[model samples]
Target: MDNWNILLESTNDGFTIATVLEVPDCQIRDETKEGAVEKVQQLLQKRLDKAEIIKIPTPIQPSTLENPVMRFAGIFRDDPDFIEIMKEIRAEREQDSDL
Candidate 1:
C-alpha cells in the first residue's frame, strides 16, 4: 500500500476541498471534511485500479547549501562551459574577498 499526504481546505462557500499531495490530479469536495477525505480516497482507489502499473519516484529531501549531497546535484559532466563558468564564479568571489 502506498501512503499519500492529503491537504484539506475550507472554502468560503462552506465546502471542504481535499487534495492528494502526491497525486495532484486527485481532488474532491464535500460539505464536511470527513466526506471530502472519503471521496478523495475513493477517487485515489479508482485511479490505482485503472492503472496496470504505478511507478512512484523516491521523494527528494529538502536540500540546503550545507548538504554535501545536494551540492553536487546540479553538476553536469557534458556541459562544455561548466568549468569556465566555475572559474569565472571563483574569480569573482576571490575579487570580492580581496576587497
Candidate 2:
C-alpha cells in the first residue's frame, strides 16, 4: 500500500488548500481540509487507473570523498573581506551585461 502525505493550509477566505507531497501539481481547495484531501485522493486514483508505474535503476557513481575540490567548500568563511567582495560581485552582476 502507498501512502500520500497531504499538507493543509488555511486561507483568509474560509477555505483550505491541500497539496500532496509526492505528487506534483496535485492541489485541491475546499471549504474543509478533509474535503480537499479526499478530493485530491480521488483525483490521484483516477490518474492511477489509466497509468502504470515503473522504476529505472541508475548506475552507481564514484564517491565525492575522493574528489580533490571537495575540501574548498567553506574556504572563504573566515575571510573578513569576503562580504565586501561578494557585495561588489553582486553589484557588478546587477549592471547591464555587454554580451
Candidate 3:
C-alpha cells in the first residue's frame, strides 16, 4: 500500500473534511475526522489501484558546457570580498524583513 498524508479541516456546518495531500480532488466530508479520512483513503486507493510512478531516461544535461551561465560559475570563487558581500546582503534582507 502506498502511504499518503491526510489533511483534516472542520467545516462551518459541523462536518469534518478530509483531503489526501497533493491530491485536491481526493476529498470527503463526514461527521467525524476519522470518517472523512477513511472515505478519502478509500477513494485514493481505488484511483491509484492501477496507477504508478515511473521515471524516464532523458538525454538532456542539467549544466551543459555550452550554457552561457557556465562562464560565470567560478568567477567569484577567487574573490576575497565575496564573503563580505554575502554578509551585507543577508543583513539587508533581515533589515527589510524587520520593517
Candidate models: Cα lDDT each: 0.91, 0.85, 0.86
TM-score of 3: 0.55
Indicate which candidate wins on TM-score. 2
For candidate 1, lDDT tens digit of each residue in 1-91? Answer: 8789999999999999999998888999999999999999999999988877758998676663366776688677667799788889999
On lDDT, the stronger of 1 and 3 is: 1
TM-score of every prediction relative to native: 0.53, 0.60, 0.55
Candidate 2 worst ten-residue window by lDDT: 59-68
- The clash count for each model shown is 0, 0, 0
For candidate 3, give the lDDT of residue 59: 89
- Model 2 compared with the native: what TM-score? 0.60
Off by over 4 Å in 1: 52-99
lDDT by residue (tens digit), candidate 2, 1-99: 798898889999999988888786888899998899899898888878998999999876667446778778789988879978998988888784743
TM-score ranking from best candidate downward: 2, 3, 1
Off by over 4 Å in 2: 64-99
Clashing pairs in 3: none
User: Which run of 10 residues does model 3 get worst, by summed lDDT?
Assistant: 60-69
